[model samples]
Structure formats: structure tokens, C-alpha cells
Target: MRQSEAIACLREKGYKQATLVLLFAAIDQLAWVAGDKETVGNEGFKAWVQQYMVEKNPELLSGATAADLWGARCGVLHTGVAESNDFRKGYARRILYASNYGQVGSNDPTVLTLSLEWLGSAFAAAIVWFLSDLEADPEKDTRAREKLSRMLVDQQP
Candidate 1:
């Protein structure tokens, strides 16, 4: 699916904890696929996590950041509790809808479908983080952009 559509779905959902879980799962899957990893297991995920670090210009793993987000997602999914009363609904529906019907590669529909889901989730999470930055008083939005740029640079072997 187009990135815009994915973001729209996430926006429509508003912001919910469960959606956050799905979003992270999707991102984990994307990192696996992007890194050409075959499995999504713990070991595999560790390697997948490394992809994020390797992509960083300074080569530091944002383990603390990832762990905090992960812990929050787990709490939400397990407790059925939202830290905020304002639980954003319809996010999964939007993700599912866009993922199911997204227009993508002509080569392999199955792979494309998976990729679409992953990309949609990952991109959606990114948008949420970006928006949070505005609220968090982020001085800059260079981290993600810089890491991505470095990934591209390193990949050009």
C-alpha cells in the first residue's frame, strides 16, 4: 500500500496500545525482511534489531528507547489498559484494510502483501513518533532520517 494510505489509516485509528503492538510486530517483520533474515524469532529479532543500529551513523543501538516502547505496548495488550483515557480506535482496521487492498509489486503478490503490511505498520509508527516529537518538544527530527540515510549509504556496496 502507499505510505500515505497507511498513515491515513493510523491517523483514523487515532492511537491505541494494541495497535502499537501490531505496529511493532509489523516493524520487526519489516526489519527481518529488509535485512534478508529468514526467521522472526528472538535470535532473529536480535539480529533484526542490529539492522537498526548498523544503519545508524553513530552506530549506537537505541535499546533503551526500543525497550521502553516495547514495555508500554506489552502493558497495554496485557492489561487492556490505556495509559490515557483517549484510546485511539480503528487503527488496526485501517491497517488491515489498507494492507489487504494495497496496490504493490507485480512480481509476487504474497511477498508484496507481506511487505505492504510491514511497510504500512512501520510507516504508521514512524508518523506517530514524529507527531509525538512535536509534543515532546523535539529540537530536531534528524535521528530517523539520518539512520535511514546511513543505511542507504552502507548498502551501496
Candidate 2:
């Protein structure tokens, strides 16, 4: 549901920042579905991302990209901002540069910029790969299935 909503929000005007936040939350949900209770934090997300990208497609979600996503997630989730260093202890925080993810193609190659479309595509690809992995070996991937089952049960009446 959240993944679908996030994708949908992408097409809406002035909702890119909100959509990016949803996207990162969806990524965490994927980790939870994969039974990653321990490494679901900032660093853990990157570690799993590194492995997932290497195992599936390194061109899509590289380590540097994951790192930038983590930083952005930290900034948004913790400080209500996109840059990690732009937050301060005050009555209100600034919401500058809502576009957390920019265009990877046009971004400077020397600088690591987190692009919304690229990460979304990479995340979608990762999800497809994970589903294929489950179909290939249910036993090996039972952790994710079990976790998903738990989530479903928890959400039940």
C-alpha cells in the first residue's frame, strides 16, 4: 500500500519531498519484510543495500547511492530537512531544498547526488529481485515470508 502510494505521489505536483520520505519508509518496510529486525537502522539499510545491489545489479543501487539515501533519510526523518548538516535546535526548522533526490543523469559526476527517480527504479528492481529469490528458494528466504506473515497478522483485526 505505501509503496503504491509513494509511486503515485511521485506524479503529483509539490509532493516530491513527501513522496521521497514515503519511498525511504517503504525501503525500511522491505527490510522488515525480509526479517531484518536488527539492521533496519540507517547503517543497516546501507549494508543490505550494498549486498542487494551487488547480488542483483550494481549499476542500479551502488554503495555511494545508498549512503546518500541514508544521509537524506536521516536528515528528513530526524531534522525535517534534506541536508544532514542543515538542522539546529530551535523552535522551528528550515525546509529548504525539498527536492531531496535530484536527476542523477544531470548531476555532477564528481558529487554524489541522490536522485528520486533513480532510487525509485533501483528500489523497484530490488523488490523484483527479492521476489524472484523467494520463488527460487522458499526455504532460504523463509525469513522474509515469516516476517511478512507477522505483519499481516499484526494488521488483522
Candidate 3:
């Protein structure tokens, strides 16, 4: 999809933090690919996501930090390593829940409203990053960087 259309769809989806995170992951993966061809296919894109996560978090799940868990989820989803399921059972739901939350109640308002708020802010920052055209205009990109930096610095708990 086109960038504007994709962003509009995201906005329509209530801008859920998880979806934003995935979009950023896709953008990051696309950025690192040397050419457009390398990024246009599912297999290459999946490998890019996995490599990005590995570069960011070499340990994968065994020794992954909280930040690493987010990358790992993107890697797992982008990779169609396994498929098929049983009606009586549910593996996808289990993976989905695990990928989206670090701890139980971590994303829910009732358990920790602050976390949800912070997640929204993080996703907003990611949106800015995903949308930036850094190569075409460095000055504009720098301003965007400063804006995001200020947003993050102000958000410190």
C-alpha cells in the first residue's frame, strides 16, 4: 500500500500500539534493504525483519530483554514458519497474546493505565520515524528527529 493510505488505515484502526509497532518494524526492515526489489517480497522482507531483530537483540528469546521481545514478535510474524491449526485448539491466539504483551495486564488500563499511555506515546514516536523521508531532505528529517527526541525526553517517568 501507499504510505499515506497505510497511515490512514492505521489511524482508522484506533491506532492501537501493537499495530503501530508492527508498522515501524516493517519500515525499519524496508529501510535496511539495499534496493526496492529486496524489500517487495514476503520472504526477503521476513528475512530482513529477522536480521534486524537479531542485529538489535542477538539473544532472541533465551536472553532477550523486554525491548527484544517486541522485535522478536515482529520477526516471528513476518516469518510464516508454521501454519494450520485445529478448531478445538488455539496456537495463533496464544502467540498473538505473547507477542503483544510482556506481562499480564501490562497493556490494560485497569491494571496499569500509565503503561498504556506510555505505549501510545512510543507508538506515536515510531509513526514519526516510519514516515520520515530522511534521505530526501536532511534538514526536515533533523527537525523531525528533534521533535521526537523532545517528545521522548518529556515522557521520561
Candidate 4:
């Protein structure tokens, strides 16, 4: 449901920031569920993105590291900025978005340009990949299920 909403926002003309927020939030939530933890700190978020998102969609996220995405996530969620402390401190590159995937370029070496559409698609693919992984691994599936059961959901009347 969250993935769908993110994609919907992505397809809209002027919802780039909202799309990013939802996409990043989905990553955080999935990371927590995948780890079977009630909470996931920065390290955990980075690790999960590295394993599940970056590694899974390298071409779409070329030149972007888990740390870069993590920094973006923090910046966007915390202050509605694109550059985080990590980017300012030389820890991660600042990210800019384009219209589609494979359209990456930036004059500044410390900055990266990616396609927001590609990002949304890649993230959706990552979720599918993660689900397949859980299906193949019973232990992981059980753990994720346990965590998911604890997640709050709107009750249908």
C-alpha cells in the first residue's frame, strides 16, 4: 500500500518531495520489519538499504551508496533539505534528481544526479525482491511476520 502511494506520488507532476519522503519512510519501515526490530537506528537503516535496495538495484542507483541515501533520508525527513550533514562533511554526496533513470550527471563531484522515477521504480522492485527473499527463507519470513504483526494499521469499519 505504501509502495503504491509512493509510486502514485512519483507519477504526479509536483509531488517530488512527498514521493521522496514516502519512499524513504518505506525503506525505514521495511528495514525495521526485515530486522524484526521495533526500532532501527542509523546504522541499521544504512545496512538494510545497502543489502536490500542499493545492492538490489545497482544500475538505477549507480554512484550512490547506502550512506548517501541514508543521508538524503535524514535530510529530507528531518529538515526537508536535500543536503545532509554527511554531505556537508564529505561523508556522502549531495543528490539531485532527474526525470528518469540513466540520466545521471553532475558537474560537482560531491553531488550526484539520479532519476526520481527510476528511484521509485527501483525501490518498488527492491520491496518485491525482499518479499521473495522472505518467502525463500522461512526464518526471515517468520521474523518479518512477527514484526509486521506488531505494526499499527487502520481498522476497517
Which one wins on lDDT? 4
108-131, model 1: which lDDT tens digit per residue?
221111233443444454445444
Candidate 2 Cα RMSD (Å): 6.3
Clashes of each: 2, 0, 0, 0
Query: Each candidate's lDDT (Cα)?
Result: 0.37, 0.57, 0.38, 0.82
Better-scoring candidate (lDDT), 3 or 4: 4
> Using TM-score as the measure, what is the rank order of every candidate, best first?
4, 2, 1, 3
Candidate 3 lDDT over 99-140, as tens digits, reads: 232333444221211122333334344335445445567675
- Provide the TM-score for each candidate, comma-separated: 0.34, 0.66, 0.29, 0.89
- The regions of model 1 sitting more than 4 angstroms off are 1-4, 35-37, 53-63, 69-157
Clashes of 1: 2
- For model 4, the superposed segments whose C-alpha errors exceed 4 Å read 155-157
Sort order, lDDT high to low: 4, 2, 3, 1
- Report clash pairs, candidate 3: none
Q: Who is ahead in TM-score, 2 or 4?
A: 4
Span of ten consecutive residues with least summed lDDT in model 2: 89-98
State the lDDT of candidate 4 residue by residue for 78-142, as single tens digits. 88888898888988888888876466788888888888877877787888888999999999999
